[model samples]
Target chain A: MEIMELTALELGREIKKKEVSVREAAQAFLTRIAQTDKVLNSFVTVEEEQVLQRADEVQSALDGGASLGPLAGVPAAVKDNICTEGIKTTCSSRILYNFIPPYSAQAVLQMQKQGAVILGKTNMDEFAMGSTTETSAFGPTKNPWNTEHVPGGSSGGSCVAVAACEAPYALGSDTGGSIRQPSSFCGVTGLKPTYGTVSRYGLIAYGSSLDQIGPIAKDISDCAAILEMIASYDPKDSTSVKRADCDFTAALTDDVKGMRIGIPTDYFGEGLEEEVKQAVLQVAEVLRQKGAVVEEFPLSLVDYAIPAYYVIASAEASSNLARFDGVKYGYRASAYDGLHGMYKKSRSEGFGEEVKRRIMLGSFVLSSGYYDAYYLKALRTKALIRRAFDAAFEKYDVILAPASPGTAPKLGQSLGDPLKMYLGDIYTISANLAGLPGVSVPCRVDQNGLPIGVQMLGNCFMEKKIIRAAYAFEQARGRWQAPPQAQRKFEKETVSASADDMQRKEKEMRSASAKDVWKTEVKTVSASAGKAVD
Target chain B: MANKISDETIEYVGILAKLELSDTEKEQAKSDIERMLDYIDKLNELDTSDVEPLSHVFPVNNVFREDVVTNGDERARLLENAPAAKDGAFQVPKTVE
Candidate 1:
């Protein structure tokens, strides 16, 4: 069997039947990461020793005739922002470059408890603040579909890891569109659970109210299985909800009969790329053909979502990030005269440009004079958006829209302009603001051979409805074909070797001056309101 | 549309955020902050007088657990992440005169 081509569930079954040992699966994935990650830059840290140790433990348990968990022996990756014990969780910023957590995130513990072997910590936007992965203090994670383009972020690395088949599945957080946007860009299935469904105990807070950790996998069923492992209430997180026992995998029926699917007309308005709109509309047709009730509806309060999201997310980020001063933990300034000076210099030097910009925007909005004008206004707008969603949910079982306005852009296309970058998130941000369960599944590929995703939004705790619908669509559409870039044979590259050589030389030069220039560039870019809240 | 934010405001905001900024960054921050503010000012078009502000999405509030420790002490492990540690606690620069 092609190890990289197997889904998590399929690999688990094979491991149980003794067709593949845990160690064999883990070793294959680790080797793949070593070979492909250099080009994709998906992982920030890969712990080979720890990974092998876990695999050994699983193999021993199996030898003792133990019934394995749903994800038994499946190799997985995690977003860097989710704390993993004994491993560095950098959030792709210099501040936490050496900050290793003493404990794993609650979601990660649950995954490990289910016999999942963590392959490594994947890279992400700095502090999960940017749209594309370009703002990472480490180099950007390239799109696996097209190496020249970006994988959408701030969960870009997680999406890339799974899409590149470096791991069977990976965990990602969606404060806004971090999981779904990248899943769409890289042509995979990702689900952003309802706001309070997944525990946030160890997820480094980007927007506390908006953040939820979810899964990215090759198919929706694999995502459902992973979600089952992690979705539980924890007393550690006050916002987490007590859920009834749910079998998300069972919800993967190929039936959408009698389902009421709402298509948001406002999502198809100006700025939505023509191809993405047609693809999503085509999804509506597919669902209708499956005996579901699909209709166009005006989702009110559409224009205010992006603005409200930025303001509220930035404000929360500013407050949450105040804990990062050099006095306690994380990076401390090497040269400083006093406590206050150290705080200033450390933050100035520690953070990347995008992170600082968000901190600035957050502080400005929550500052004394501007609090009511910006922050309070945003809160009210958030309330309105939530109310609008609630009203819509009363009518429709699920809402459908484009995951992103278009396919992934070139790496630096949105980096130079902040507003343009923010606009790419317009379709995905409202679900976060409303605290609704949202998912993205790859439906079609655009002319540029990039993936396009159709998003589904369901009411709180109604993930079953959306998952059932997406599964039906997936069944009808068939699984996405691996992009050409993903299937590229590593050894027989004849054309791009000189280009690769030039890139290697450039990388050497960049790494030489990266540290000094990183701090200065961070300061320079901190003034711009970079992408906010995941 | 051109440079709506003033430099003095950026300085005050930077101080509040505990970030040191150079003159060039201050200028960049001014333009960026102004552009963002201008974009966010779109909310001013609607009347939100009757709307209640929502700080959280869920209705649950005052979630209280038994006031007891649920986790073991891991002071050494926690301190391992500290940039500067001494005497089993995080050490910082002098605060007193």
Candidate 2:
């Protein structure tokens, strides 16, 4: 098998046995990224020299007889929202286009300490505000399975990187299905840990109360391993939790005997695509046959999740994003009359339409006349949603639902209708509302050939239950195959030109100080230039 | 529940958010906010009168730490990414002329 085909753990084992050098593994994935990422748009920044340098460092550490854990030599992608020291972490927005962090996120530090080779940041929705990655200041990431469709977001680039085999695993932050929905759309596995399980420090807060960083990978095992490496308690983030039961890999057993899996009947109702519903139900069947006790149950307050989620998340986002004025680190208006003018013009010019809408919505909900009606009511609804999940968990160990209403939608279908996009998050947002751990495992491919995911949500801090269930489901499902486009090898001559062009564009971007030049350059460099294979 | 968000409200909220919106964007924002508020009104259907507000899902209290210096000053490094910095501090436009 090719090095790109190996799971992260598999590659780590080969490196440990001296069969594969860390440099070789990193190079193989980097080469794959060079060839495939043009079409996928899976990456925002890919520093080839830095990646190789990290690989060499890991190789030296391995040669010196130091064990750095399972992810030692793995090349992992991080969503651009996460801070990386000396790297431009833009969160796929123009406001932070020129901003470089002085300190790395706690998760990035954890990965670095484990000797993992950082493969640069992946694109995401601008400040992680939208369901489709199309809202990014950078271009949207196309689904690997089909280029016309979106790889769901705000973790689209991370999911696309893994799905297209550009990277073996990636770190994706979830705030209301950002990780799980994209994982489903891209035919990958993603896990959003319970609130505070992973430190939120330097994650570029969108909705602080709901956002939790997690892992997206080729399968549940890789997700578990990646989660194990990055999950930690940091004093920097006040919400970071210290957990004694964080050994996620230990729950990889195939046994789900007598495990109670509750399928929410509400999730299978109207608006759910028939094929998607069947695919999720098939997961229930597979688990049932494997000795899991599967039954349908009513998960109350299902319809209220989206509105409450939007209200609360937007309120938090308004407060969190208030930091990005022209003064501190980020973009500044070239000309402004005064302090207030600078703030207004910089934010107005920097933020995209979707971001502006959310900010306005948040401002409205929290404004004087509307706070008690909209903001406080949403909080009360949030409490009731949590109580509903608490009650459901009393009877069932894990609740199973469809990750999205259906498979991946076409690239432009979601953005025009913001409410339609918001409703797409119905199935997955409740987990964030209740602070539950949720995992999305690809169940089956729809008639349109896009993959559908079965989401397993567990009560707070019960990551093991969902992971075990997902792992068991994966075992039953057998090995997943990458999309034909990703697996197809192009002739070297056809690939080199586009790859070189991309490399040159990246170089020019690094040298250029003007943000407008960078934006125009990105827009002009279309991936369609390398479409000779189809 | 206000089904219709007035143009005045949008303008006021724009000022609160520190966003300068053109007339086109203001109209767009007005309709969008109206639609979203209409949808958010769904939450009103479920009587949450007895339920307490849940700001954070987890029962985490305010974290406390001793007042001890963790690291030496890195003022230069901190100022590296500033759009306008001088004398080892962020420089903003004059608030009072």
Candidate 3:
């Protein structure tokens, strides 16, 4: 099997057994990314030299009889919003395009301490404001399942990176369903830990009260292991929780006997597509067969989640993002009248339309005359929503719902109608409001071949329950099959090229038009004599 | 109570946000905010009079630590990313005449 086909743990086990060198593993993924990322556009920055140097350092450590964690020697991608010391973390926005952090995020530091090799920074929606990654200044990431569709966002690039096998696993931040929605659209497993479970110290804030970083990988086991490595308390972020039970991997058992799973009837209503409903309901059916007591329950105030979420998140975002005036590290306008002019011009020129819109809305709601009616009302509504979840969790061990209302829409379908896009977040946003642990596992694919994810939410800090339920559901669902593009190996002549020649080819391919590259990729996949891996 | 968002409101909000929107963008923002307000008006239907507002999900508060500095001065490193810097300070446009 190819190195890219191995799960992160499997790759780590091979490296520990001396069967595969860390350098070889990193090279395989870097080469795969070089070959595929031109069409996917999943990465914002990939420093090959740094990746190789880190791989060698880890390899030497292992050789010297140093014991790294389970993910030691594994190459992982990081979402662009997460700060990496000395690496450009742009949040996929032009404002911070040249901004490199002087310090890394607490999660990135933990990943490094676990001996994971950093592949590069992945693209995301500008400041992580939009549902579809089309809001990114770098350009939207196309779905690996169908190149014509969006890969969901603002964690689109992170999800696409894992889906296309560009990286085995990646870290993505979830604020109002960024991680779960994209994971659903890309057919991968993503976990958004209960708020405060992961520290937000170095994560570029969009909505401070809601943002939590978690893992995106091919399966639940990888998600659990990655979560185990990154979840920790830090003094830097005041919201960080000190939890004694951070052993996420211990919940990977395929036993859901006597587990009470509640399917929210509100999630299955109205906007949910027929196929998506069936796919999600099918997960509950499978769980029921495995001795889980499944029943449909009303999760009230579902309709109010989107509005309350937008208001609260936007309010927090406006406050959090006020730090980006031209005075500091981000983009500065070339000419302006004074300090205020510079701030206005730099921000107006830097931020994308969606971000500016949210800022404006946030400002309007917080303005003196409207504060009581909009912002405070939203907060009160948020309290009620949390109460609703609290009431539901009293009887249910896990709440099963669709991650997204439907499968991945065509690339341009979502952005035109922003309200429609906001409504699509109905199923996932409630978890963010209540600070619940949620996991998105690929249940099945629609008729169009795009994947549908079944989201399972557990009460605050009950990550183990959702992980165990998701693991059991995944076992019943069988192994996940990669998209056709990800399964294809390059032709023999291209594969056998010298290192310099391959690099030159990769450069040429990147500079070529995306259409031409797509045609070349199609031809190469067709010409390959190798069979597709299951 | 979905009050119609006016052009004056959009312009004023733009000022509050420190964003300079062109006339066309203002028109767009007016319509978008109007629609959003219309949707948000649904919250008025629910009775939240007795509910306390939730500012954060976690109940933890007053997180305090020692006043001693954990990080040493890294002025040079921090200034490296500044758009303009001089004398170990970030330089901005003239604030006061």
Which candidate gets the maximum DockQ versus the true structure? 2
- Tell me each candidate's i-RMS in Å: 7.3, 9.7, 12.2
Identify the runs in model 2 with alpha carbons over 4 angstroms from their true place.
Answer: A489-534
Q: Higher DockQ: candidate 1 or 3?
A: 1
> Model 2 over residues B51-78: C-alpha lDDT tens digits?
9999888777888999999998988888
Evaluate model 1: give its lDDT.
Answer: 0.86
Compose the digit string of candidate 1's lDDT tens values, residues A224-278: 9999999989988999899995578889899999999999888888989999999
Candidate 1 at residue A109, lDDT?
Answer: 91
Candidate 1 deviant stretches above 4 angstroms: A491-534, B1-3
- TM values, all candidates: 0.93, 0.94, 0.93
lDDT of each: 0.86, 0.87, 0.87
CAPRI grade, predicted model 1? medium
Model 3: lDDT of residue B38: 91
Of candidate 3 chain A, the 10-residue stretch with the lowest lDDT total is A489-498
In terms of lDDT, which candidate is stronger, 1 or 2? 2
Clashes of each: 0, 0, 0
* Tens-place lDDT digits, model 2, residues A1-534: 888888889888998898999999989988888777776777888889988998999999989988798879889999999999988899888788778899999999998899899898998899998877888776777788887889999999999999888898999999999999999999999999999988998899999999999999988998888889889999999989999998999999999999999998888889999998888888999999999999999998999999999999988888888998977777776655567888998899888899899999999999997999999999999999999999899999999999999899998899989999999999999999999999999888888889888899999999999999998988988989887777774333235544654565466345434344423432343243332110
Give each prediction's DockQ, rounded to 2 decimals. Answer: 0.54, 0.57, 0.47
